[model samples]
Target: MSTASTKKPPEVRLPPKPDLELRLDKFAQLATIFLSLVGLLFVLKTGSFLLAPVSLAIVVGLMLAPVALRLEDIGLPPSLSAAAVVLIFVLVTGSIAAAIAAPLASWAARVPQIWNELQLQLQLTSFSEPLATIRSVREEIRNVTGEPNVTVSVQDGSPVESVAVLAPALLAQVLIFFASLYFFVATRHDTRLAILKMCSGRRIRWRAAHVFRDVEGLVSNYLLSIAIINIGLGVTVAVVLWLLNVPSAPLWGAIAGVLNFFIYIGPALMAVILLGVGLASFDGMPGILLPPLAYLALNAIEAQIVTPMTIGKRMTLNPFIIFLAVAFWLWIWGPVGGFIAIPALLILFALARNLIPGFPWGMPEERRRRLSRLP
Candidate 1:
């Protein structure tokens, strides 16, 4: 009897099961989120004609919003504020176009001459191997595919016809961009209030407010800071190149400033362009390398020193994330994708901080500092 009593085990305890309705609700929520994301990406990829302009407009508007707000604070109407911002933007763009249009056209005119020089130089140097490998690969592919020795030619259309074909689409995009930008700026307050009102609870409204504020502040401040830094970079490059006797130094500087916005890819492309320009404009290997090398040095200073001091980590994103965003958008919409990638990241991260629990994006200074101290 004693042994039997001792053999009795403690009463077993079981945890309460999750409610079926609650589990089902969570699954439904997750599924809805997944489907919404898929649909959004599909629309973005397929609707570039409309979406790209809208996206660019939104980013531009976001950046210009502070100006609009300042104007409003100064007793200007919303419409007037939006108009002033847009007009200023137009003038800035026009100035940039005027600066580079002639140089770009001249370069385009010299492409054949440049190509001839490049070929001649390559033959006399050790840099032709890569091109030779490409040709050899082409021959191998032709052999594999049994290619026909047919020559196909494309006829150049009249300039008028080309313009006629192109102008409407470009005009449409411009109009859409202007319209979206104007409306977005004009409705800034109304839009924010509407967003808050749409949220069902006080917590959600507060989060929405944070997201709206952060997105506007992050995109505007980052763009403004970078633009200021790039302006300095452009002026530095222009001065350096002018001293170095590079033709169209200002144009190259302008190009550099614009391309620097693309981060790594822009600089590499700029280096290659400068290399070609140097080779075309000067003689000997040393002369050919000077411009690009100088640019690389200046770029190093800006990227390493100026940008970090100016931008800090307030809106700093992982390079991998930016690269992927650029690559993804590039696949969808080419150059426009590259321009919007950073802005898109800023907006997404701003929203993520407010919407996603335990997520690290747009983290506060204290939290970020704590993270930096971790192993």
Candidate 2:
């Protein structure tokens, strides 16, 4: 008691309270970021209808730019020149589609026979044991479901009818794309000027122009080179199929050409189809294996040799980025998205590189390093 009375009570000190406004501001910032992410996802999910047309327009513009430029060089007005290029593209695409329809129809009609041949080939090859195992698994599934009579059918209907039904939609899409491309080409200069005006400073405007030019050159060159390479691959496949006496060789080749747009998955699917057809047409494993081997060889040449040589130095994309882009687009818009993924990626990469300082953005240094490491 005496000690307590002699000692002055130490002044109790409490920590300062956090500022509510600052805390609230930090929370608000986090919420805004989360909501923005959600909004972006929603747009991607629902915006395919809009994106499809725009993407198609970009591709069409790339393919037609040279033609339009040539027409302009010959003294045609830009608008008229763009129109001429679009018309030629439409006509050529239509002709090719029409020419291949009948052969594709034949191939579709023969699906049942093809399956049977594939079954026979599997029975004769090293796959026989695996096929038996699969049969056993199917039997177990049937037993578990109490449906012993369950049968699977893989047959498809007439390819011509399928094409006919889809033709209107395809035509509408083409028209929209071409119309948009025409405007884009005609107004490209004005568009650049507008962009420059909107930018805050000279440095930004200069960077924007450089990025635009780079994107245009990359996309145009990629489109032309891919077209040539795909055509060559198609012809090669067609010749091989014809030599092998495969039915509807031209149709298969056309399918190959279209599928080639999808990269790794495309060639794999074509190989499966070829194997099936070979099995149906031939009685031995040798025949069945030929299609896959031929496709593998052709793809190897295209991927390893042709693409590298033709697209050299200019096509500077990270493989992982390309794969991710393809997957993302395919998830959003199915096969159409898959077909346009590369060009879409190129545009995005160009924009990102121009806008961000630290990012690689498909630059020459990055591309050269990547190619140097490739086998």
Candidate 3:
């Protein structure tokens, strides 16, 4: 009894609880974003062969969706409506291509002569020192790398052989593109339903629905509006070019119309091209400056006046953000990247708005802290 009484009570221990501080799980979120970006870049780079066409088709399909919707409202079957829309799109594209082809061919044939003339003209300029410096730097890099003194002579295949080699892949991309567009248009409702099904609650479903509708409406309307404006820009340029007696006015107009979709850089590039062509075609500074200057004026009006009035201030994006998006995508995928960049930005903007509800873009400190409260 004495020995039992002398024994001390058993030692007790408990697992420590984590601190329940009111801090955001910033590390986890940052890691998730980082990983997601890495994965996206990998897929984009590796699957570019398939993904580029698919992306283009999706953007095109979104633009054509209203036609399909209107047809459906008139009691056409979804498949039939989608088919009709796709057919119309194809016809329009083909017609434009046909219209531009002859002029483009003519311009292409003149490129060598233009290049020669440009070189001759530039020789009397201050550019010679920079060119020599560039050559010297290139040689230095070559010597440092211990590169072989190799001349790569491109083996010129027959045109027929080149076409044969390229045709299958090009054909496949076209098929995939059309197929994706048709399916997306026909099954849009199903896609929406599937998205909603992934959500567990009414609130989530509602938000998802809202996001889907917002994406569809914003993307389609923005694209349509931009298309109309761009068409007008092209027509104006064509008329002006014709008045100026530019040899391939239609081709330049078409090029301007397409390139204008890529903001800032596109117009600058078009100006450069026009300037080069001007130099090639005309003798003096007045003749050389006219086309690009006229274009600049027209573009300024369209950008500053027409677009804002049409697209609305609400739809406008930050110039810095747009520039970054364009640069990033262009570095990754060239022209295709540029084409998708704005649409992608719109989609992301829509998503961010939906996710955070009234979060200001240039978020202040207090607002930034509120991101933790985002649904």
Candidate 4:
């Protein structure tokens, strides 16, 4: 009688509700994109030896593409035009290397002395007591843990051995770079056409075409403009350092120019380097402070004024975005990554504008005003 009073069947498990399903689908898509990005990054990092040079080649090719086209307009064949461009590039690179070699070598020879001086200076700082306390604590921890002081000796290989190990890979990468550059420059037009033809629809083809055109134009203009600005900066730095009686003026100038390409990290590093240079060269605190402060002032002017004017608002990027890009690439590929970060961002921006519907280029003043009117 009690059992008969009330026995009900179990409730069946229903499929997810429509809203829940929709959310799950969106989450899956996001996860897929994230995983794909991680995979791409892994490939890029592991294949850096091959990919790094190839990436450099692609960026250089894009930058030099207009020059190649101009040569072709003069009735030069693509092969010869590309060759000429590559040759010019090689010559320019060689000249820069030669120019910096002597001063760089002199500085390299002074590394040990510099290190000692740097250590002495650090010990003179207010933080030295805290550093000493930290070192003592570390020693005490090791003693308490009964960990023996392990002397791990690494034998230095012969110079020839090091070079021999490195040279083949370096030569291969260099060869890959030149070959890739030459072929890319030569086939760029055909390559664009080929990509367009592969698209399944008129809309797709149109987008592809714009992507190519925008990428080339934007990258070339941005790089060329920055190059001009950096050259001016370098020259100004050299003159300033020379007037300040700093040794290796040209070397520091070149370093400044090259490092400036890396955005935030570069200028800060240059300041630190200049501080060290000052320390090595002069005895007074005023001397140590002068070089970094001077450079900082110049950098502030360039960044706040000249760069904006030169690059224009259209080409200008968000500072936070640029910083993130630099940090990500620097982590992935070292200095080379930093060098190519902006161009790569430009390429992605071009792609996004073309591929994404209603994606704005530059977010014009009128558009921005309209956006500002929104709740």
Candidate 5:
């Protein structure tokens, strides 16, 4: 009976193993990064109304920084210089818009004619049967559902009404853009100093300074060079189109130039637009093909030869990476996102290379070594 009363002690539970703890810590870090990225994307999309214009202003400010600094060097105050720069930019943009307006208005006035032409041309193709079948099916479905065709009359949703609704927001964004540009320009130097001063250590401060320098140099040079290249490309497009008797040659050229900024998507869109232009202008195959084909040839030359020469090897970025960046930004912010994508990538790359010692993933070996050697 005494022996039977004896009982075993309870087993002890040991703490988690070191390896398990390490894995959990790593997972927590990953989770934090993922959450941060998600939050950032959410903020960018939701706050696009403010963020988009500010982003654009910052890019524009960087492009014009050299001009602002030059003005300051010539004894103009930062405020005055910023104002002058902004005014000049507005004038240039307005001039371009004005140059485009008359042609655009004329073309818009001919939309019905173009639509008819497009329909006729499409009917002449193999797609006619498929399109007709789809239309018939749609009509049958509408009938079955007892749904009348929706028509937007002037009272319902006129362009004027739409513009009136949107104008205030547009005006506000414009004001925000201008104000952001002015302030960024005025405070550029002070901003740099302030950032550098906030660094915790000498090495970190040095890296930060280089990051700023690299960002300013790369962005400004890339933008300025691109601007020059696009102007040339635009002029070339205008002359070629004019020679081909394409209507609104200057307008198309200007559109081409502006679109060229978006890289792959832009050129492809321009081609589609030119195809539409071709269909609108000409009745025969040669006429229809000439505009797009000629533009393609010119674009090929510019992209392959002139652009590389102008921007230089140092400014070159991976095409795939550029496309991805453009896609991501465009998805988030529409056209403004597309406009800022390249600059944003450049800025990110500069920061990464300066701040991280082994960030040579996309860099050339020599360049990576060079960057690694930096303090």
Candidate 6:
């Protein structure tokens, strides 16, 4: 038998290929893009809730990290050390609030009275004389031209109602701030370690370390300098108000100091408040003019001399960028956003320096030279 024609038909075979692998790779890329877009949208939409507490926490943590480290050096466990830091923060904040609370309340009560007094002062001032002349001119024109009947519309709302609405918002903000601070203090080490682990390669690791160190130094220094400057501002404002015989001088001063955190806008708002107070309490242009003048002088000194000296080139950011950051955050999250803008900018600059090699801004030439020189 011819092997009984048992020769089997040639077995069929398929070519080996990498279609599955390619498909998987494409899917992963798509997934990554999708996730990133989702994250970005979430941040843009709900940023106000996340940004405020996060910014406050970061600031608080930066300010307290040294203290926590010191406590650790003295043999305290990390958790205890963190707790101690939180306690200290709470106590300091509480004491400051307590110290200012009564005076602020008193000032709040006196605002309406002050407003009335300020109106009277404005009526008597040299500035008011121009208004009187304008009125006379208008009357003469009306008399000669023959007056036409005019009607006015008024909207009615009580100021107290506005205050009532604001109170809850303020309280909620305070609550969020404190809670965030506590959590930041408690988790700072974990956060740092996680960030470090996320980095790969020796150069990346070193860059991360450098960037974090710079952030720590810059934020701590900035906060300390701000605290000192604000205290001085508050004291100066209080002294001036007292000398000028303004009621609740300390309260106004404290307000000025606190608001100064928001930079140009804060001072402008405070100027309006001071102008109103002057109109209520004093009797002429001097009253209105003096507050604005005093604020201008103090701010000029702070901006030109004290800030430059204390902050130095280490943290110098472009003024235009700073202003835009302020505006952006203010638009996104209002006053709290403005307060956090500088520190947020610092964090952003630091991250960019690390993540994006050879970024143009914020890379100090001298520092590079020194680094290059090091063995």
TM-score of each: 0.79, 0.73, 0.77, 0.82, 0.83, 0.72
The 10-residue segment of model 1 with minimum total lDDT is 366-375
* lDDT computed for candidate 6: 0.78
lDDT of 2 at 327: 88
lDDT score, candidate 1, position 140: 93
**Model 5's TM-score against the true structure:** 0.83
Q: Candidates' lDDT values, in order?
A: 0.86, 0.78, 0.82, 0.85, 0.87, 0.78
Q: For candidate 6, lDDT tens digit of each residue in 1-375?
A: 698598888888977658998899899999999999889757855866656776777787888888998998999887888789878988987887887787667667878887677667657667688889998999899889998747777875689998898888878877887777767777777887888899886566666777888788778887888888888988998898888788778888988888888866788898888877766666667666787678678878887777766654546677668779878877766777777777878888887875675887645777566555644
How many angstroms is residue 313 displaced in model 2 relative to the true structure, after the best TM-score fit?
A: 4.2
- How many residue pairs clash per model? 0, 0, 0, 0, 0, 5
How would you encode candidate 4's per-residue C-alpha lDDT over 1-375 as one tens digit per residue? 698668888899988679988999999999999999999999999999988888989999999999999999999999999999999999998998888786788777877777787777778876589999999999999999999999999999999999999999989989999999999999988898888888886666655776788899999998999898888898899899999999888889998897788777789999988987888897766777788888898889998889877775657677667678878888888877988888999998888766565666643466345444644
Task: Identify the runs in model 2 with alpha carbons over 4 angstroms from their true place.
Answer: 1-35, 119-174, 242-251, 304-313, 358-375
lDDT by residue (63-147, candidate 3, tens digit) is 8888999999999998999999999999998988888786677666878887877776567566678888998998999999998
Worst 10 residues of 5 by lDDT: 361-370
Tell me how far the alpha carbon of residue 320 in candidate 1 is from the true structure, in angstroms, after superposition. Answer: 2.6
> Which parts of model 1 have CA positions greater than 4 angstroms off?
1-36, 103-107, 128-148, 154-160, 300-312, 361-375
Q: Cα RMSD for candidate 4?
A: 9.2
lDDT of 1 at 349: 89
Q: What RMSD, rounded to one decimal, does every model reach?
A: 7.9, 10.0, 7.1, 9.2, 7.8, 9.0
Compared with the true structure, what per-residue lDDT tens digits does model 2 show for residues 1-375? Answer: 687799988999987667997799899999999999889878977877666877778776876777788888989997888788877877998898888776677778889888777666667678899878999999899899898694798887699989998998778776777778778877776788898899886667666886888788778878888888899899998898898787778778888887897766788898888887777676677776787788789888988778766764456665567678878887877767877778888887778776676686444576445444644
Off by over 4 Å in 6: 1-42, 125-173, 242-251, 360-375
Predicted structure 1, TM vs. truth: 0.79
For candidate 6, list the clashing residue pairs, or say none: 114-280, 117-279, 117-280, 118-279, 118-280
